[model samples]
Target: MRAQSGHDPFDLQFEADDDFGPSSDADWRPAGPAPSERREPVEDYSPAPRRRAEAFDDLDAPRPAGSVGDNPVHDMIASAEAAFGDHALPRITIHAFIERPRTGDMIEHAARDRRMERTSVTVRDGGLSAALLAYQNQPTPPLLVVECCAAAPELLAQLDQLAEVCDPGSKVVVLGAANDIALYRELMRRGVSEYLVPPLKPLQFVRSVSNLYADPSAPFLGRQIAFCGAKGGVGVSAIAHNIAYAISEGLGANAVLVDLDLPFGTAGLDFNQDPLQGVADALGEPDRLDPVLMDRMMARCGEKLSLFAAPASLDDDYNIPPEAFEEVTQKVRAAAPFVILDLPHVWTAWKRRILLSSDDLVIVATPDLASLRNTKNLVDLVRRARPNDTPPRLVLNQVGVPGRPEIAAKDFGEALGLIPALVVPFEPKLFGQAANNGQMLAELAPKAKTTEALAQLAQQISRREAPVAQKSSLLAGLLRRK
Candidate 1:
């Protein structure tokens, strides 16, 4: 596991495409002659209108009519979802040299974005000249942003000089006051990542940086939803497993459920699986766990669902460090579209890290005094730790247990300032039968209310809608009856 501490951000390697760097053509310096000998007029370029059929010609050849890529609207929606999804920016440093205070302020605000939490950003007021001076003796960062107000020729000359000090593989983005397409193209030819005109929004700057590192060929990172109990015996594991199964089986999405409770996890028994290698093995050697190795360690529970079962043994000590868990989970997310983490009812540094970093968190608690206190504590910690994110969802489970004095769900929620997402009554028969039969609630009773609630929870966390059932017409119903 690589620790975020004790490392230089500039030394971090960015996974950029080979063509991302400047071209090797000798004429790549600039168009025409040297800046001192000749000057070219900058012309305003505007795109010509195209016929409806020709509009999409520049895009990839059309896919099958029913495929997602065939519809431009669907493609845009998918791109947005992937961009704002549960992925974080890679650990790298960005240095911005801006001559205007507004640009520097925008970049500073963009640096505080949640996706940029892992990145380090420094904003200076010196523009391109300052960058040239700074990087002359030191190494350039992975990404650099410089603002220049010069025209095409002067800007090109300055960039040509700046290129001498820039290290290989370092990407540069230019911010200027001009909107000339010719300048944009010339910058592209010179290996600049992007050129933006002024009046930039903070989110726009963040998205530009995000797009630079976006790989069209890389696997999509999955959304991770972690489930943990407010106290022991709150049935957190069962809820997590059911939701994961619902996401895969009901919503038709691929999902992976990881049991992080290495010593006493019940995922194997719940799914009736016995894999020799599981999460413990991956955590022990995170650097060696690639996609091929991950497939070998996972237990296939269904057509669309997989399980990373824990060893669940007491033969050896399981004093694994927190970094190992982080590294293993990061690898697992790339293998599926949705990941469910069934966290044990214990507090540690690793548990806190997972809770804070998860895309969505579900805290399950029974209706009681002790549960109330602990749930409030957890909620407060999450609220403070993740101010930019949505608050952790609260689930009041086993609300109406017989012969036990329990607090009302409304009162419990009022105390914590969070409304319960779902209030499930005490139903021992259904849960027990499902457990005894080694099946999920949906498998045992598909029409049950609790099963439906779990399915809804799955949809909520995954940000995906289940297929809607169409209503039959009256004529069709009559024909069928006849």
Candidate 2:
């Protein structure tokens, strides 16, 4: 694919052969199926006339072969492509420096195809030095993507000098031949937005730059709170729904409730919304999900609350990648200030990532050995992984079930070294009525203790309250012994 204009941004090639990585001969190839492996022919590749123009729509379109499942890179690229559509190019400016001819061509193709409407993309030859010299007197664009054909030390040195000229708010991405983890870590520590090695997958390159411009510290971006159950029948879905409702109604925050238990999700029933279209629809075609599409998919539960009700179907098994979850939640999060993920009681890599990455976490568990064991493990994993964030809030639900021989709340807390933030008594009558009526607990019984507890939890999360303990207690030793 070629650039759209005569002065194509990615047309130039660098003259340096200094060394892109430790291994000088490491070849570059475009991402996805190798060239020799593509079986389909590019038959009649003209895109249908639309207001927006794309230089390489055919490349971004779904491969006739199938989906690019589970590739985080692919998902990120897809999201970037949508954001940088021809309509959004005018306000953004991108500067790309390429060392390899093929890499330049591939990047130029992607930039023209996915660039925001009216956005200017300037590609020049002469890797790092060219950029340094170019920006020595001129102002750097909002984004700068430069290539380096040097080893780690040289690359780092060049970047240090480049940093001197970069504007305070400008973001930088590095494209090099280096694949060393240590170098990657050091680059990250020194504040590099992203590093990519390439024959240049156009999508991946574009996505990396797009991510650099996504201000992670912005307050308007939604905060994801992953809610999971310690054991089955622990009412995690119910708790998640209530929390979302409290956030929306009581706290006056726009909230999105996503039910992820594809097979047995109760979000639809809990909210009294039919499952015509929702999370399944969004996940089915994640690449198509934008704010408008997401708004159409959500079922508005109240003034500020929307629900992405799961299909909860049993006819066919749902085999979606964890990346799908990341994709859907990411889009949905952008639509509201608070995103409550009703995660299913299943432990998987995707689930683990969601748990670890959430801005806040709530573990709904009952007082039992199984709940105790699972909750302990989950807390341990979270505490170790997210040492800086507050520990996951533990909610002891259904604490007083008659003749159930339950564990004591204090013992449960001591065992996990995490005191339950809220203890909800087993009130079957209240829950059953709310479930049957398709109303949130707070709506059905606003003055009830459970509703008050739910509200408190919401405040804690929204306000970023400190945890009682910074580290888990020694109860982990007892749990292991048991």
Candidate 3:
């Protein structure tokens, strides 16, 4: 029967046995016990010892705010100013695990700060436990923030678990409900970077983060002051060059004037220089720029002032990218104590970026209807873009042009919600002579009101004063022995 069906004889035997039932129960025993669940070893939960030694050693020390002459306090204030100035935060990743909604909102708002524009920020819920769980197998970021709602002992224990997962060199800031000094000291001893009690403001949080990364030993970066016009002929370039000269000559500080108006810049012409290579060259090859190359590219306008003149040529297209401009400006600022950027009236991405990033901005506008509207728009953009910074300084240029209908300086300032820093009247002969001679207002007429005003503006922006000239005394000359 099996041969006719073309089936195996073993299959036929098995079918016959199934019909008769199993003779023994040994063939159907259950499988072995399921494999035990895998888990990380408990021994790996110990706090990292390497970072404990690197914690702030002066956590318990009393920080005294001394008088004006105190060097320590002055140093501290200067450091804070540098951190809050035009210098942007370094590139780093931040992960914030916030449990309280209030703190979470503040952290989110702080992430939107201009200084944090280049930083990577991530906010998540569940606080320390979530951080502990998430970073068990993965690496922690450069900065880690967590909110703990527990008491001192429990918080310290949880922090131990958190420290185990944190990679070496990672900074940890804890947000807690307690304001106890003992708790703060203990946490610092255990390698906590900072411990803050809640009710935090966004700016305060930004300051804290900035202080952590500020390097006191780092080289100084110059402050940039950008000048732009509301219209094409508002004298922005001339003002910028004069300010640069004043800062260098009057205030006795090294300053560099960079002409960003590639096609129609007047910095070279105003300073009476014809450079071989200038700002255009630096922008063309930003990657190759360094202090040495920058030195070679600049023309020495004065003993303390350097000029990065523009090509002022229309023969070639100036299609440099926005990032290149930023990179070149950064390099230029590094070489001096103060930098003046002469921006053209044309609007572009690079121009906007430079204006917003400048430590100080000056807008030169004529007292005309068109200038009023354009100035209003520019002020609004600056306010919206730089919420943390002060408003742009306004310079009322050519205030009294005879027979030309003009808005009063007071009225213009009222409309813009800003007072005019300097109101320069229409002095055609003085300006014309200075331009023709390639001399600043101060050089042509030292005692002129306009020259004094320009000098005062320079002093105000640079936060410095010119050395008082000693009056020539006949008695002093007689007193000197031969």
* Candidate 1 Cα deviation (angstroms), residue 364: 2.2
User: Which digits, one per residue and each the tens of the lDDT, describe model 1 over residues 261-291?
Assistant: 9999999999888999999999888899999
Clashing pairs for predicted structure model 1, backbone only? none
Off by over 4 Å in 2: 1-220, 464-482
* lDDT against true structure, model 3: 0.75
Q: What is the lDDT of residue 10 in candidate 1?
A: 23
What lDDT score goes with residue 83 in model 2? 45
Task: Report the C-alpha displacement of residue 459, candidate 2, in angstroms.
Answer: 1.0
What ranges in model 1 sit over 4 Å off? 1-81, 84-91, 98-118, 126-140, 147-169, 174-191, 195-205, 215-220, 285-293, 368-373, 376-388, 402-419, 468-482
User: Could you say which candidate leads in TM-score?
Assistant: 3
The alpha-carbon lDDT assigned to residue 120 of candidate 1 equals: 95
RMSD of each: 12.5, 18.8, 19.8
In terms of lDDT, the best-performing candidate is 1
